[model samples]
Target chain A: EPEVTQTPSHQVTQMGQEVILRCVPISNHLYFYWYRQILGQKVEFLVSFYNNEISEKSEIFDDQFSVERPDGSNFTLKIRSTKLEDSAMYFCASNAETQYFGPGTRLLVL
Target chain B: EDKVVQSPLSLVVHEGDTVTLNCSYEVTNFRSLLWYKQEKKAPTFLFMLTSSGIEKKSGRLSSILDKKELSSILNITATQTGDSAIYLCAVAGGGSQGNLIFGKGTKLSVKP
Candidate 1:
């Protein structure tokens, strides 16, 4: 079975620095999404993308956060200024109807 | 805004026991309810229910949805240590966009 894959399984960055998390969604999946989970917390939706444009975003997705599908397969989430609170497991998902998730990128900002 | 709530935040059961996890949601344009099993990494899809009162089953796992009450239940029978994990419930709303609203999840520990 084809599965979504993410790069940089784990990352450590300094506060105020920038970080980019990458994902390769399953082939033929049309819709893409980004969600995050603080340690022992619920998964929170950040944003959804379709047709190379953002469809909807939660308040948590602010100016500091951006998503791009730079190519056909890669979807990336960029944080302009990382904060201690930004440390979490960021997951990328894709779906035609049934969604599939990537292993996730663990972001740690100190 | 949409919200999902799961009950019995954490459960401990012995092998061969039966367990039921509950999920409820309040959202506009509810399209479908889905269940996933998460161990350490990516969550694995378990079931998707678009209609009410219909049961979907896979091996020892089964799920049913109640659209009228906006709730769903995932049941695991003859549970084993391998069944221990966090189970997540998510709801998708009507629209072409296909975004998911997820609950905090129910953690299950099946001990032998």
Candidate 2:
């Protein structure tokens, strides 16, 4: 079965630095989404992307966060000035009908 | 605001036991409810319930949705140690955006 794939399984970044988490969604998927789960917390929605634009975003997805579908398969989330609270497991998902999730990228902001 | 809540945050069962996980939600324009299993990594899709009173099953796992009650239930029969994982419930609402609102999840531990 085809699955969503993300790069940099784990990342460690200094506070105030920028980090880019990358994902390659399933080739035929039309909708893409980003969600984060703080340690011991529920998964929280961040943003959804479709047609090269943001369709929806949560409060956590503030000015510091941006998503781009720079290529056909590559979807990337960029966070500027990362904060300690930004550390979490970030998941990327794609769907035509039911959403499928990637293994996730663990971001550690120190 | 859209919200999903799961009950019995944690459960413990012995091998060959049966377990039921519950989920309830309050959301606008509810579209579908989904169940996922998380084992130290990403969540793997288990089932999706779009209509009420209809059950979806796979192997020893089955799930049913009750739109009238705004809830869903996931049942695992003859559970094994491999079944120990966090079960997450998520709801998708009708909109252009396809993001899912998730519940805190129910952790299940099956011992030998």
**Per-prediction TM-score, chain B alone:** 0.96, 0.97
For candidate 2, give the DockQ.
0.86
Please compute DockQ, using alpha carbons, for every candidate against the native two-chain complex.
0.73, 0.86
What digit string (tens of lDDT, one per residue) describes model 2 on residues A1-110? 89999999999999999999999999999999999999999999999999999999988999999999997889999998999999999999999899999999999999
- Per-residue C-alpha lDDT of model 1 across residues B1-112, encoded as one tens digit per residue: 6899998899999999999999999988988999999999788999999999989999999999999899999999999999999999999984447678889999999999
- After superposition, which runs of candidate 2 have C-alpha atoms over 4 Å from their true positions? none
Candidate 2, residue B55: the lDDT equals: 95
Listed in order, each prediction's TM-score against the native is: 0.97, 0.99
On TM-score, the leading prediction is 2
lDDT tens string, model 2, B1-112? Answer: 7899998899999999999999999989898999999999899999999999999999999999999999999999999999999999999984557579999999999999
lDDT of 2 at A73: 83
Residue B33 shift from truth in candidate 1, angstroms: 0.6
Q: lDDT of candidate 2 vs native? A: 0.95
The i-RMS of every model, in angstroms, reads 1.6, 1.0
Candidate 2 docking category?
high
Residues A1-110 of candidate 1 have per-residue lDDT tens digits of 89999989999999999999999999899899998999999888899999899998989999999999999889999999999999999999999879899999999999
| Residue A81 local lDDT, model 2 | 92
